[model samples]
Target: MTSSLQRAAFAGTYDDESLCGSGLMVVRAEAEAVAALAGRIDAYFAAACKLILACNGRVVVTGMGKSGHIGGKIAATLASTGTPAFFVHPGEASHGDFGMITAQDVVLALSNSGETPEILAILHLIKRLDVPLISMTGNPKSTLARQSQVHIDTSVREEACPLGLAPTSSTTATLAMGDALSVALLEARGFTREDFAFAHPGGSLGRRLLTRIQDIMHTGPEIPSVPETALVRDAVLEMTAKKLGMTAVVDGRYRVLGIFTDGDLRRLFEKAGDIHTTPINEVMTRFCTRVSPELLAAESVRIMEEKRISALLVVDDDNRLIGALNMHDLLRAGVV
Candidate 1:
């Protein structure tokens, strides 16, 4: 049977006030459930984490129905952080997938009522393997909670569901507890940003931490360059040809002397100098900033922002120009 709120929604009798009131009720209920979890993070929670940390193999999380979905996300968060973990459906675990859990692994079982049939079905197998069992349940006195080596209390005062049949608040509490476990384990292991990058190599944070200037900088023939003796016109021609908005001024030995850019061209224009006659080195900015190929693209971003510059030149040990890059390059590489 639906609640009055549900009936009103179905009958199109709900106004904005009623709709918002019902939505707020759900939000408040879920919020209270999650808030209660803070106090529940007691000794039992620590014990669960200890079991996971001491495990030699992996964390095998299993649950039935809605709990299974939360288990999958929890497992993912655990695996991505520091602890290796994966989700297994309780129904599937009884069907030979139980072989996946060895004595070296720890099993984390989820069941709000603490008496899910599928979860209980795997208890004998889990016991046979002598694996550590950690359970999260709303009932501390329930069978699953009693059988587990460690039991975390995820009980909610009320479900957000109007009829109290849906998983609403229970699932949120379980997911929050899962996050707490994952992050606690992560901190205990002293997981670093570099370690996280290895797990998420394709993510923006990974790209920022792992990408070197050489990986995104214009290299070889793509580098815009001109000899110091080259006229302003020649430098402008090279810049336009390379489309980098600037050209490196180098000596005959290819060692960088300075840089000529669009800004310098504008200054030259104000002074009424003949672009074809004036040498680039005479009008270029001397002692221009340079970066090494091994520098991180993220570091280059800091340098650019601090110096209020839009472009940078990449140089080798001998100060020879090897590459060039602008802010646009960093943006394209997602370093920005």
Candidate 2:
């Protein structure tokens, strides 16, 4: 019931000594090309890195067709990793997007053939605008390379496509080269995890990497708390008022002396005793786990999970109570 085209497509992916071997061969060749470029990461690489690092504006990357798509991706990678960058289609550059480029910016152009017409037509304009040019191309002697202030040779041995026309290995090499440039810039600038967090503030990684305990901890009146001399009823009231299912028992200076939780309440209610007059000191968990405000919220999550507790009291170095946080707080902060 299979059609000829579908059968042919499926058959290309079968067997060990077939076109699949050729496919892997092409990939291996491209990987070798990228590895060879590692030795060329010298003055030209340094100059390109310096150009982008010294940029007071942004990195405007441009290309045409498949190269343009790769350029867009490279621009995004650079931007997310602390180097400010964006992409402009070369075809669109003639349609007025070129206004986005400024004298303070650097232009990173990409082309596999190194002779993309739309890209070449703008070489003089880039020079006139005084924007430094860095090109990634397969041919070192191509027009883009000759016109570039810095040329990164990303040549490939062959196309993975059997037709030898569709870009495959060449694009992979170009992307890897872009990654090399981005990581080099990231290190030379001494960009930190905190800096990366700012760029990715909306994701789970952002929450874990950027947020501190103080930023998400429950404090002030929201912290469920009771005095050491307080009765069980009072502890219950504090827990209810804060809706955190627990309360920290403090001494005169608000130092965390013990903690009473809903589970403790359950145990008390189930015991053969009158709850009305029992002091929380008799029923509170004195050996409660505590954390510091400077600790990462993710670390708190680990501690809470390890101890099997739903809440924790945050204290200062002096053991004085500072704040409180619960599983709900972690969930709300997106740390969970």
Candidate 3:
């Protein structure tokens, strides 16, 4: 019971094959453009990395229009990956922003045609300051390319745009070139995960790599623990009071002997045992998973997931209970 208008509204589109073909064509074109850059990583690319590595001041990246957007991202990637870099709009460079650049700084300029007016306008200033210039462009003979100390060829065979007007494949080629530079610098500087974590402290990768169990675990009286001689009722009371759904059964030295959880209660209920009179040690899970306070919170998450457990008892080298945490803590700390 479908109306003709409803069917037309839902299904009246261009041919599916044509739409899919267009998308595939664009993707293939961009892939080819990126692939073509592999062979162009010659001595000039290595020299560019050396210049940035030897630079004492920050890298100043500039471009016009769409190239500017790509330049900003490239600068961000470089700064986060160990190189100190920032973006400057080519138009703004003519203004007072040009003061941000110094003789020690390296300039990375991008333009598909290699003749953007704004970029060209600032070339004389860069020359006067004696700053190293690296140009990424499609035209090798363009003024910007010829003037640069290191010229990267980011030429694309054709535009992904069917009209051959919009900068689609050319922009992709430029972005890939930027990524290549950043990664080369990153490897050259021996950037580690710890350094990356410091740069991205607010990100999930930082939380996973930098956060330790001691940073987020519940310590002191917040831990729900009872002597192994305690009764099931006492254990249940401790679990309920702490709201951790579990309690660690420890010895007089505070060494973990077993663990009692809500799951134990469910299994106990199936038997005729008296809850109040039963010793927790007789019904508790003897083989319990334990973690150290120094362990990474991300490693704790992996252990919990693999063991199918929600809570873990934090123990010291002597296997004595020092702290405790649950899956909820990890989730709250953004480690999950």
Candidate 4:
């Protein structure tokens, strides 16, 4: 019974367009709200930052429902970025998690309405413990905000949800503000990638930045190398024995001068004369890629990829061949 135009309008306008429009509107409105409030940081925000910075223990973030979800994420961001923080459920706080909070700890409480009954119940206990309280609420004059040592306004003009009822824009604004705070504190404290590696030592970045080159390269017997004056036959034997697809050609002192690979063998095989009698120096590539022992194995992998090579010679400051790595080595080490 519906006209095609009506169906098209409904499909194109309210269905497909609505999603992006509403999401963008929510983010734009939230960004504006945060920018407006940034000018109002005043004494309250300063007090909150000061209290948190002075605390000897962790920041205990707590809230109920959607606010609780945001609080947990904020706590994680803060902790990963150099601030010691964790989230406690408001319901659980009243049960036993309240004991987790110490006098030296700071409380970062969230409640959009500033009237989460469970959080309100813990205000007195928090005060009694002399722990500084930082409240994030929409209502500045509400019980939780008024009772706190510092308050951040997370008020939203309206919900981005058309029904005017969901915690869409409000929660987004709170999360953005939380991220801003955590990143600011992280930069102020000079938190580095190495510091982050300690907390996330199982992930890709932890493995890449935290792992040393010595842990992954092929050394000792597995290293493929030949003396500079060695016959091409002997160098090919070393490469085949080590199974690295290439062999480092070094002088008597073990100073690496070049490398010989399968590519060189293929090129030499077509020669009109005796190739086995040829010296490795005659067929070796003099300007081959090399890396230092102290360099990251991941970086060495990148060099190999960029140079379109299958193997790299690891050398010391004096260019002495000490190790070697190939694509297979990188794959096995998880550095690829």
Give the top-scoring candidate (lDDT): 3
For each candidate, the alpha-carbon lDDT, in order, equals: 0.94, 0.90, 0.95, 0.86
Q: Which numbered prediction scores highest in TM-score against the true structure? A: 1
Measured on C-alpha atoms, candidate 4 has an lDDT of: 0.86
Ranking by TM-score: 1, 3, 2, 4
**Tens-place lDDT digits, model 2, residues 80-124:** 999999999998898888889999999999999899999988888
lDDT of 1: 0.94
Can you give the TM-score per candidate against the true fold?
Answer: 0.94, 0.85, 0.88, 0.84
What C-alpha lDDT, on a 0 to 100 scale, does residue 40 get in candidate 1?
A: 84
lDDT of 4 by residue, 1-336 (tens): 999988887776567687788778877866776666676567766677778778899999998999999999999999998999999998998898899999989999999999999999999999999999998998898999999888988888776767778887778878877887788778778899989888788877777787666778889888998888899899878988999999999888989999999999988887853557898888889999888878887787778778999888889999998888888877876667
TM-score of 3: 0.88
When summed lDDT is taken over every stretch of 10 residues in candidate 3, the lowest stretch is: 9-18
TM-score of 1: 0.94
Residue clash pairs of candidate 1:
none
Per candidate, the number of residue pairs that clash is: 0, 0, 0, 0
Candidate no. 2 TM-score:
0.85
The window of 10 residues in a row where model 1 has the poorest summed lDDT is 5-14
Colliding pairs, model 4: none
